[model samples]
Target: MSWLPNADIALLKKRAVIIQKMRRFFIQRDLLEVETPSLSQAGVTDQHLFCFKTHFVGPEISERKPDPLGVPLYLQTSPEFHMKRLLSAGSGSIFQIAKAFRNEESGRYHNPEFTLLEWYRVGFDHFQLMDEMEQLLKLVLACDNATRLTYQQAFQLHLDVDPLSASLEQLKVAGASLDLGDVLDNEDDKDTVLQLLFCVAIEPVIANDAPCFVYNFPASQAALARISKDDNRVAERFEVYYKGIELANGFHELSDSKEQRLRFEKDNRLRQKNNLPQMPIDHRFVDSLDSLPDCSGVALGIDRLIMLATGQSHIDNVVSFTIKGA
Candidate 1:
């Protein structure tokens, strides 16, 4: 029947076991488990992230005359803002395994709706968090070792170009050599070119024998991570990849209220430029920065992690249902 789940009944059982082990891993470390609302009035303004919008209807539409379409709500792309609010209110060291929603994300490693394992460490930086992440993965996936590389190092080793200083033209040439697709002559931005080349030319080469952590991304690509003090040109961010699949993203949290606001504004401007819908900035989250402790946080895709652990190739093989199946 078309209504049946995509994953076999046996695979579903294995997925449950993985989740159980993950919970135990965090519990032993004394990280408090918490939950936040999946819907919000405000959403992330990141240009690259798209939110699914919905409307609420009251029992009687005419009774509420001021707004007839009810409050426009967004299915949260991540639980980051609400979790950060809790951190601001002094809920130290929290974690959640929650459902997250996104728009325009689907395929081998993505789904419009998926489970996310997000956690925050009160006093840890990106490096310390990476260590914790490694431990968690090792325990859950039964892995022993992981490889580490800087963004520049990964580029140099794989694509043989200095990522930070490479001109747009150089990246275009590299992309052309890879034969991924046409690199239009009009494209001039460094970040855009670098990202395209990284995904096509470099990402596929990451070793599958061990997990990989690519750290210290260029400053421009940092979403919420703080700029590294050691190197102003790079952000204190890292991503985990297993078997050529990106499994998680971690950040040395940026706590500056002004900078956070500026970033949101910049994201909105980019959204406008690209003819994408601009989102409302989460001002409350920005306000909470004053109370948020020095911390590091990460969001991991539960489905992808399970896929890696279970030796599944397609993301749909591990999940009970995919969007199309549902």
Candidate 2:
């Protein structure tokens, strides 16, 4: 739209306008838009995240490929950890529109690369942030379908069980009866099992009549969110959904570096058990924990939001050029 030499005109215009709307929406709330470095001294440790590995030593290096003693560089999965660091550094409220990457994921709803709209707000807990998420969707789409449901409630209403308190034996039994859970078991991978159940059992039944937020996650699955005070059995996190598709994820961010480190360890252990590569910990980000405020943050998929706003279904429709086409 602005005479970009590389980007397509029509797609550029749409992306530009969408970004404009997003920035103005947040700006009205006095949230600061900021930038962050794409590369880091270390990489993400989340087992669910798969970073595209690379070598980034300067050209002056004697070794060209960064082999043998190469310094590992990677494409970021999300700007979340860095943005959280900013929160710790007294950045009261901030947002960043960043390009993120993940390896071996390509589908109608996914790409190897995509835009991530990550933001954080201090002084608000997870539910407060859920309210904020509703505001964002309402403002962005000019719609009021910010419905709320707990994970357990969603599961009970859809799958006829309480996910939080269900035993492994019970889950395996219950899951073996569902289309999504027939392959999952307590003897199998928990993440994969839960994900399979989610895909087949619960996620599809979300409020298609309106936008929805599913909250109160299991504590064992609490990626980086704190355990709920009302119920330590669950975490204070939520995922925003539209038309049965996941659009965003938010958390009452876990502030204790110790707890954060433990989660990272758990994730890596799972990854190792599954034969996935273990990533290095981001120490600088961990160091920022001392200065980080009590806050809640979210990362929303801009491509998916655009798809919903424009009534498109596939992510490639919103992307200017997809990995397959590129």
Candidate 3:
């Protein structure tokens, strides 16, 4: 019936155990647990992400109280912006297991609303952060040491193509083998092509027996990560995969406010081209970057982790309710 939870009692208990293990892992490292507001005046600028918007109505005043329509607010896609504000305020090395919402499709591995385990490590590069991520995954999943690869290496191994240097023609040729049809025909974004190839051809074939970390992504796809000093063509971004499931995404954070603003503007431009609504940039977050320390941050999917830990097949099995159930 509608009154019952989507997940069983045993799966619910297992989820609790997994979260406890995660908290213990962070606490031992001296990372403070913090919380940020779930709703905010501004939303993320990433064109790929969609936010759930709402309006806050205050107590009834006169018929005219300036703008009486109330202020538009958005449910956060992640706690990244607010948590970075805490770091700018001198909170060293913090973590949060927060409820994140996204307006997106739901399936075996996704829910519109889910729990995310996100953390920031001061004085850590993406590599160092990967080291910590490896330790935590081993402890929580009881899995073996993870294998590491560069984004280029992964594309080379799986598709026999270089993601960074491949021309649109070359990418389309490779994508042809996957029967992607016109998916890449009219698409001009190189990063979009690489992502389709990676998702359709590579992610499914990643090492499934244990965790595999693919790092040094193409610079164009570097969401908030810094471009690598050793290689200008790549950014210090990484993703953790296990059993064909993308478990986490991490970045060596970019600290330049100007560059961040440019990226935000670029995303809005892209949104305009694609007929999507432009998202308001979180200026407070941009303002905090001057004091933002050199660090690495990662966001892990808790429902997927629980699915792996408990041997459940779908996200619905681990979460209390899915969108339909809700």
TM-score of each: 0.95, 0.90, 0.96
Q: How well is each residue in 1-326 modelled by candidate 3, as lDDT tens digits? A: 78899999987987888899899999999999999999988898888899999877875432334344786789999999999999999999999999999998589998999999999999999999999999999988899999999999998888888888889889888878898888879889888888889999989888687799999998888888999999999999999999999999999999998899999999999999889999888898999998999999999999998899899899998989889988
**CA displacement after TM-score superposition, residue 217 of candidate 3 (Å):** 0.8
In model 3, the clashing pairs are: none
lDDT of 2: 0.79
RMSD of 3: 2.4
- Sorted by lDDT (best first), the order is 3, 1, 2
**lDDT score of model 1?**
0.88
Mind sharing the TM-score for model 3? Answer: 0.96
Ranking by TM-score: 3, 1, 2
Candidate 2 residue lDDT tens string, 237-269: 999888778889999888877878877777778
* Candidate 2 residue-wise lDDT at 36: 82
**Over the full model, what C-alpha lDDT does candidate 3 score relative to the true structure?**
0.91
How many pairs in model 2 have backbone atoms within 3 A of each other, for residues 3 or more apart or on separate chains, i.e. clashes? 2
Q: Which candidate is the best by TM-score?
A: 3
Which parts of model 2 have CA positions greater than 4 angstroms off? 1-12, 59-69, 180-182, 185-187
Error of 3 at 31 (Å): 0.4
Error of 1 at 260 (Å): 0.7
Please list all clashing residue pairs in model 1, or write none if there are none.
Answer: none
- What is the Å distance of residue 295 in model 3 from its true position? 0.8
**lDDT winner between candidates 1 and 2:** 1
